[model samples]
Target chain A: MRKLPELNAAGNKIPNRQAICETLMEAAGRDRNVVALCSDSRGSASMTPFFEAFPEQSIEVGIAEQNLVGISAGLAKCGKKPYAFSPACFLSTRSYEQAKIDCAYSDTNVKLIGISGGVSYGALGMSHHSAQDIAAMSAIPNMRVYLPSDRHQTRKLIEALLEDEKCAYVRVGRNPVEDIYSEDDCPFEMDRATILADSEEYDAAIIACGEMVRPAVEAAKLLKNDGIRAAVVDMYCVKPIDREAVLTAARRAKLIVTAEEHAPFGGLGSMVSQIAAAECPRRVINLALPDAPVVTGNSREVFETYGLNAAGIAAAVRGAEEFL
Target chain B: MADHDRTDNVMKDHKMTNSELALLSCRLREQTVDVITGAKTGHIGGDMSVMDILVMLYFRHMNISPANMDDPDRDKFVLSKGHSVESYYTVLAEKGFFDFEAYKNSFSRYGSEFIGHPHNTIPGVEMNSGSLGHGLPVCVGMALAGKMDGAPYRVFTVMGDGELAEGSVWEGAMAAGHYHLDNLCAVVDRNGLQISGRTEDVMSHEPLADRFAAFGWHVIECDGHDMDSLDAAFREAEAFRGMPSVVIAHTVKGCGSSVMEDKAAWHHKVPNAEEAAQIRADLEERKEACRHA
Candidate 1:
């Protein structure tokens, strides 16, 4: 893959969604079988480059999400690797039945890409937010769910997904993200978690996925400065989650804190908590959005207000010490 | 001239005449009723309504069989109305795709491959469909795949009139039209009644043919129960090119049985032993009449 644009003059990284377009364009160029289907959100789904580069391989299904998924499943059955891209809210809720029966139960090789997941649409309100996508996607059998932390991970995940044939849902936020990895090549696997921070002894372990991974890694660094020494693990692949990674973190850390930009009930927090409850039984606190509608703001603003940013996570982890 | 006559003879040997096929339809109804009665749970009304259409597809039209099921060049059929699976299963059995006795005995029993809906596990079934509005879209995909591979295989699917109300069906219709999938043929089992009421009373699809035509499909309206009409419609569909085809097969719910025809209660109701016997006698009488006629 070509090198991503240099970080802004300030040296801050750009969003990961662009990496999705870049990687998909490269994939379409390399593999003729790799096709992309969009529901009139080709621009928003960041698939313009792939559309321009490989018009023959991409399908524009207008505004129909159900047909987007059903047709993708059909193409998959016909021996094509299809990625059905739409905003997470509609892709997970409107076409949910098609995703469940056509793609998952029918055992087709369609990859469902839920763009702008987890309040990434920000001011567009709850109607646009996709906080429950992980919940809806995780419940379906034979569906693999993942959320890459940044551009590097997004590139690796897309490459791996194209090579394998299975039903999958990958959620990516709308905007650029802080770089978590310096290079595209990393120790990435479809079913394993990546440990961003390691510690011999830890006061708490922060497990996170998708947009939350950067803040989680930041929290770990801050906790270390405060002498708390929290270990941060990127639980990118949510379904068939790395249970062994959770157990390892739980054994070393005094407390386990699971964070995600999703509902408190399901998603990364819930999956990790379930593993901790049944196997390790540590003091587990899930940092996630509440059941009520999320407050309207930009993604950074919402995240900051809800204790999801680096400072918020560090404080939450430090405060959980009293409970422990 | 001799070679052509020999080829014609071989074709005639494999293809059942319309009269013979009509008689076979009655026998299939008997077996369908037996399986549903044995299971004590199945969609009988729509099954009888769509039985003749299924016979035309599996027995005569579709280029599929147990031996050629795995061949990509073979035609594909999806039972989109999946609830009418009783008739589909019976027809597949009659086609030698599987054993009728084995399927009839184990249907709907815990773990039987012959569950309530048509699934790929069955030898000749293409896609697992019981949910309405799914099969057509999948067939469109298959047909598109055929066009892409430059393979000479056609795709077919059947849906119930009640199932036409689903929004996804229209979405698939729009896509099939936009893509101009000429290799695809869909048949709507227009049996008038749904569980709640008549299809027109429930959701008037009165301009159904026009609707499909507007969506770029070549539409054919025909009597679903008339074996000749269905055969002719499918033949026309096979010959048509440039756009997808949809045969609007108007039918009576529970057509073969005296007590069940046009009744919504029989939509999924299983017949009791007495009613089953009566239906069997009715089919036997129909078979006798066809023999004499």
Candidate 2:
């Protein structure tokens, strides 16, 4: 684990998907058992370099997500660590049964990498978006769900997963946003939330995951500028959620705002609210994409429309008085 | 030689005769019927139909055993027609993988590891499969792993003809051929019936051989109930390199019984006491004829 960079100086952004590909390529270079499988999405996943480097360790299933997962699970059974990469919308829903039964239930060490997750396929419209993946992947028993906020955290998460013999799902965004952590200084831990902001007199805690984490930190800054302190958390481990962190965030502030690029029902918001309502009852304003087909545009435009940006979050925090 | 090396020698050194394998199937079919009758729930029809194929693989061919389970080079098998797990349980138990009584007493009961569908938690079961179309793709993976490692292990799976209707089966079929996985052999129990009706009525997988052939699979058709035919089909599959192989085993739904034979109701129907007696009698007659013949 490295020290986190100053929240104000986040710079030199890299796509989390690229980080996953590079890290997997490096791992496969060292260990022959590390395999990268794709459903004809190597170019989209930025994994063509890995495939080129270790042709033996790369499998192109050619647009079949179900077979991609099933074959990955099969390879896992043969003592291979197969990382099955596919687009989130099809992989999570289309190959869902394969993940549940073949990988998780069968206890195969297949890592499901859902790239272009959430609304990251912004202009491709709802058919290509995966607003329900977090909920779907988390529902499977023995499946560990992860949504790393940036390149550094994605590296940490992949490296940690490589060490364990288990079934896991890793969801990463398509585009590179401004770095939330400087390349030199990103603290990392397996299955634990990264707290970006904490203050004794904080007014709210905005907990987020995947592409939404940086905006959350920015939201904390906006609130701080208005003489209001707020805590920000990167809840990367969505399945085995950081309960203690959610509890602490509940304790640090009066209002808890959960932000994500996923749907409202079964994502980060529902999880935080469930935990807060049970252990530490607090007001949770879950800001997520609506249940309906969201407006089509680029990711930024969609985020802005859904009130998932810094200003929207800051305004939500400022309007927290209505519930109080 | 080491214990495993000796076991390997023993396995290679002594393959069972086709008649002996047939006798073993006769007994296992009886056992399969007993459990499904006692439990009052199972896919008994397909179990009887696929019994000889499973027997031939475990007894005569396929280098998998309870002793050599830790051997990475040993062949992997999955009952893709997983509802037929009752017979698989009997086969593995008979092969000395685990205690028969444990599975006999508590199968499908709460907390019992003898789950209705086969899961890897049990000895000798490679993949947890109940949903159709899952096993073949998984086997394709296993075979591909062996091909990648240049390992001498093969992957085998049995699917019901009805299971071929699942689009994922075709997806797996394409991959098995596309990857040129010669180490994979799939046997379809073409018993001609599913739960609802004859497979053609429900969903036609006819021209099934052509279907698989179109996907680039080398298809072999054989009489499923005959041990020698299964042996020949499997042997041919093993020798056919550079592509995956499929044995389209034509079998009767309830192979060893007059009461259940060709009956779709027996797919999940439990036998009454009278029905069990008749089925057991028929099996005994078949066993005597099999041993003598």
Candidate 3:
């Protein structure tokens, strides 16, 4: 196996929430029609900067998630591109019917930004954790789901959404996260997945999304140390999963292991498995949160306890080789 | 006749007879019921309840041009109580927005744009709506945009009395009042019934006009089926400034149909051949009575 380098030993400098708020404010400053609607979560969603900077563009619906989406759809219909921000859990579950009818079914250009997604709100309990946001959002047709790897990717994704007219749900992290890409690589395509690690010949491919991408990178190095060459692909755009890249990886590799910090059903793993079953039928293994409610702990400890860390991913990748 | 001659010259230019407008309203409602019964599926209860409001808005109240639907300065209308799309589609067809034939084949074939609700695919449809309680907030946004852009276009939306139970409707109500959308008007079809049972039994929205008044909207109560009252309520809405307006249109659940009137079962019932024939005969009798009157 290849020697794995320490991940973010120096620690993260930028908070993901502030980074997203700044990106939204920057976009609002440039466009007059750009507006932000929140469900009494301007502080929690880190939209205070936007509220202060573009007060005219900020609309606070006061704890009304359904109206938050409905008003945003109305604003979008009237030639405004609106960002509807709220806690991921409530935004995904509480106003799900409105999200389906007002935004997706109506084909409104509304960006649904779900803040503090996927256990990022650790210790606040499972009620706050947005583990099922991906699954819930993916079921709605015409909605593009994006789970960015880090602050940089989140900012890039926000910029990309300003030009994208389709309905989108961006699952944003709350806490500080290590940057996965360089500052120079500021722009990324919505449909393209970034290749963090790869080799000419690989026995297995490690496909990961969102917070799991960093671990997949570490898992790739660990596999290489044990004389196993594993490729890593960051599947950021979960809905329109990069079919070409996933198929290529499956054809070239002996086994494909998908990982995510989300529910196993209808998530990145399930999405990749469906692709593999149809195009490149290969032995696929999925590492994800189970169907039941997750236990309470700090984000890192819970991930490790649930076997969702780099070690768990590497172990799953190695186990899939038996079928190959 | 010197005083009468002087009044005639002054009033002739602005005078509009309610009989002519009422006949049109009756025709619009009859067509709405006929199409729904023919298609064998639709929300006939709410459609009958809101028909007069729709006719009044389309014929005499709102400044809309069927030939110029996309005109930037045209007034906007949102049917928030979207299950009652039968009335909206019939009025739009009669206004020449699209062919009445299209309304005849609604919800029949696959890929038919005219589904059970208002969709953007249909001409003159502002927003695709079927989900209850979504129309008001969207109308608020449109009204706010018109005010911001210095446009004279007004926005009107219809809400079901039952839908007022939704918290989102109240949220939108607060926003519209807070924004001081004087150019915005909302009408509630207070038919007193919903799908399961009477609105009061299902979930009461009693003192509904008081709720709008409490929300800071200029509240007006009127008979939804009366063309004169509808016209008067709309005029009151237009005259008001610095606050949104709500016309609580008291109406029967199934107006105009003797058998279906005030019946909740007709909310989604497909009229059988015998019932349909009876309804057609009643409509023809009403038409002839109007001609003689």
- Which residue pairs overlap in candidate 3's backbone? A1-A224, A1-A225, A1-A226, A1-A227, A2-A224, A2-A225
True contacts kept of 2: 0.83
In TM-score terms, which candidate is top?
A: 2
Q: Report the number of the highest-lDDT candidate.
A: 2
lDDT of 2 by residue, B1-293 (tens): 33345335545734778898899899999988878876778889999999999998888677788988999988899899999999999999998999887887788877889989898889999889999999999999999898888888878999999898898898999999998988899999999999998999999887999988999999999999988899899888987878899999999998999999998998888899999999999999999999898
Residue-by-residue lDDT tens digits, candidate 3, A113-153: 99888888888877888889899999998888988887888
- Is 1 or 3 the stronger prediction by TM-score? 1
Interface RMSD, every prediction, one decimal place: 1.3, 0.6, 1.4
Candidate 1 TM-score on chain B: 0.94
User: Candidate 3 docking category?
Assistant: medium
Compose the digit string of candidate 1's lDDT tens values, residues B1-293: 23234224324434887778888888888888989888999999998999989988777777777877666677778889999888898998878988999999999999888888987778877677878899877777777777766767778989999999999999989989998998899999999999998889989997999999999999999999888899899888877878999999999999887979899889989888788888888888889987876
Q: Give DockQ per model, in order.
A: 0.63, 0.87, 0.58
lDDT of 2 by residue, A1-324 (tens): 112234655455568888888888889889999999999999989999999999999999999999999999999999999999999999999999999999999999999999988888888899999999999989999998999988888888999999999999989888886777756777778898987664554678889998888888888878778878788888999989999989988987889999999999999999999999999999999999999898989899999999999999888999987643
lDDT value, residue A145 of candidate 2? 92
Which predicted model would earn the best DockQ? 2
Comparing 1 with 2 on TM-score, the higher-scoring candidate is: 2
TM-score of chain B of 3: 0.91
Off by over 4 Å in 1: A1-14, B1-14
Per-model TM-score versus the true fold: 0.95, 0.97, 0.93
Candidate 2 CAPRI-style tier: high
